[model samples]
Target: MNATDFIVSRNDLQQCKSIETQPPEAAALPADALLVKVTRFAFTANNITYAVMGDALKYWQLFPAPKDFGNIPVWGFGEVIASKHPNVAVGETLFGYFPMATHLVIEAADVTKRGLRDGAAHRQVAAPVYNAYARVSGDPAFTGKQGDYQALLRPLFMLSFLVDDFLAENDFYGARRVMLSSASSKTAYGLAHLLHRRDGIKVIGLTSAPNVAFVKSLGCYDEVVTYDAVTSLPADSPVAYVDMAGNSDLRERLHRHFGGQMKYSGRVGLTHRSTSPEEPELPGAKPSWFFAPDHIRKRAREWGPGGVDMRFGAAWAGFAPKLDQWLTVTEGRGPAAVQQVYLDTLNGRVPPDQGHILAL
Candidate 1:
């Protein structure tokens, strides 16, 4: 069967194409291999962050592509059209990481009734979370609109959950307030949601003027301020900054404004792509990148097996239902629709409340 992939230029994300190619033959499948038909996936600013940080974070290495082009990874559901593993069967559906393509061939290892890991050689160095897939039947979040919510927000929310857990584990670095930039983005608001629920810590959201109202409507932040108002916040209060926008100027402003009062500066997403990679030494706390996978590994050892899941699952239960009130899902099908959504997301035209679920 022909597989169509949506790939973006590593040098210029705006330059993209949907290329059609031949997939592995189902009949000639290797042992323990499964051919999955890509159903649908969510497109968000998070995917754009993957492309922007592709080289720096090895995101481009996840799925190979032609020279100068890269396949952006996504979270979604797929059906197994062919299977060579005895434990896995055709027609079973799975929810996990997938390329923006029509099909995928997975070398299934560590198979279980719940799911299996993609034991492909190229993916070994990556985080296990990206390689793992869950069976649809076994995933409680796979039902009804919950599945779309899962695809759209679960991965991002997992990052939010981990960041929240990490901060709490460290006693929030002795800061009384936590500030998140790009507050309208999924990950930012997701973190805001968790932080808002906790007492003794104030959650502040930093966003663009256009998104200020939307961010405030989420009602998860104690205060929502625009980018220009960064200096308006009390500079003397001890606070933690979550750099979700990755705007260099804003980062410098926050650091210089707060000076030694900025207890922790944790860099997260790059929703704002027009920024230099080289960080200039500024006052206050040094900026450190928060890699969610590393935190997951640490928690897995500390919390033991299923401990993180139990905690995250309980948190998700509370957060999932809130999406129905906060997000509007928009469905698109075929290559043309997929390309439009990709370009819109890349160009920052997508509204904060709208979520796109595309099928190829």
Candidate 2:
């Protein structure tokens, strides 16, 4: 069998190139290894965050990349074509983080009935979220589901689930109104939907004027405000900002407008990748980086395993069904399509309503 891998520029992080070669044989494997046939995966702004922050967060270190080149990480489904481990078997459908390639060789450790964590030497210190992989067949949510939702939207929604839980856990930092930049983004919208379901606080969607209509149509936000309309928001009322776009200029304008009334600001993603300006002094709350894994671990400890599940499960039950109403899932296959769509997402050209699932 043969394999293909895509590596992008590590220094500039601009371009991606593909390489094809013979895949590793399963005849002789490590004592405990699982050879997964990469089936399909999702790519969106979320995946772009991995590449942009690869060096800072060590995304490049997770699945090894060639010198001066890096592989982008994605969440997707794979099948275990061969396993040398006693616990795992061939033909098992699994879900986890994977590089854009034909197959991945995982050294499985901390094996469980549901699945196992990738125990590759390089991954030991990485976040457990990426290290963990699930046996989809054993899970009810994915048992009979197609690759559409799970591949693309589910991962983003998970972050949304965490952000919503995090904000509520902290009582939205004493603000009754929440403003979400890049509100049209899947993660932002997912969070907005969860926020809308709760009482007391108002969920306001902030996006570009062109996207305002689409963001409004999602029916998640209580108010839809365009980026140009930042000053229009009430200065008298306090608000918390959940930032997804990572645009510094907009942050400054927001801080200037809301001033001391801006109770909290949480930075979530960098959908606008190249525009990080120095954080200038501002009157509002300082923008804090919202790392989803930290919150996930925190809640898992605070709520216990099942208790955490119950909270997110109850939220997902209310939000998942409404997804089909707004999202139109599409697939991009082969190396050419993968590369093109990667550029599209990185450039922020992909429309909010079209969800992309890639098979390479």
Candidate 3:
């Protein structure tokens, strides 16, 4: 098999590189491993977020790459072409976090009705949520129908759903208005869609002028305003700020404007990759990075085992059907096509409503 890997410069992520490797026979795969032939995955700003925070989150440690290069993690569907594990058979499909490569060998363990976690030695310290792969045949969200939608939104929307639930559970930190930066972002929209339905609080979307119309069309936010218009919002009202854009200046502006009324600041993503590294504080509650795993663990304790799955699955069912109204799935095949999609996402060249389904 000739498998290709997409690598990005640690210094300049905008520059991408690909390496193709030829493997021996399938019989050469390790006795306890499964070789997955990656089928499809979504390449979005979320993947950029992973690249940007790779070191901090230790994502780069998951699938090691050569010096000066990083292998960005992605969520996708893959079929096991060769396996030596007793429980996992060849031909079974799995969906979970995977590197942007044509093939991966998973040291499978903890096999269950749901799926098995990749027990690769390097992954022992990684978050369990990303380690577990679900068999599509058994996964209610991806079974047979709607597999495209699942591949596109499941990873991101799950984070959005969890973030919304976390904020709601905490009563939006006593704020009557919820402000989301990067409203055009898929994760931002998913949360906005949920908050828009909540009573009392207003869901406000902050986006660039170019994306203002697109964000407005989602109808997920009660109000849509460009970053230039952020000052138009009242300063005295209690507000919960969700910083999905991760631009330092934008965050500081919101902080300086809202002052103490900015009830909570959650630093989520850096879609604006040029965002300043040094934080300039003005006035507000301290911004906390929203690590999805921590929140997921807390909720699991409060809601019981599999509680998240039950709630997210129900919400996903309802939201999945409505995707056609907002998103377009575009298929890109082979290594070259996949490379272009990766570049498009890194350079923020992809359209707001288009979801790239990369196949290899």
- Lowest summed-lDDT stretch of 10 residues in model 3? 136-145
Question: Which runs in model 1 stand beyond 4 Å of their true positions?
Answer: 138-140
lDDT of 3 by residue, 90-157 (tens): 88989998888888889888898778999888887678988999986556557543777787788889
User: How would you encode candidate 1's per-residue C-alpha lDDT over 45-97 as one tens digit per residue?
Assistant: 99999888888778788888999999999999999999999999898999999
Residue 356 displacement (Å), model 3? 0.4
True-structure lDDT of candidate 1: 0.92
Worst 10 residues of 2 by lDDT: 138-147
**Segments of candidate 3 deviating more than 4 angstroms:** 138-140, 143-145
Candidate order by decreasing TM-score:
1, 2, 3
Per-residue alpha-carbon lDDT of candidate 2 for residues 1-360, written as tens digits (9 for 90 to 100): 879997898887567888985766898778889899888888889998888889899998987778898888889988999899998989998899998888898999989887799888898767888888988766667643345677677778889998888888889889999999999998999899889888998999999988988998998899998889889999998899999998988998999999999999999999887665677898889888998888888888888867866877687777778877888888879999999888888887899998888888
- TM-score of every model? 0.98, 0.96, 0.96
TM-score of candidate 2 on Cα atoms, chains taken together: 0.96
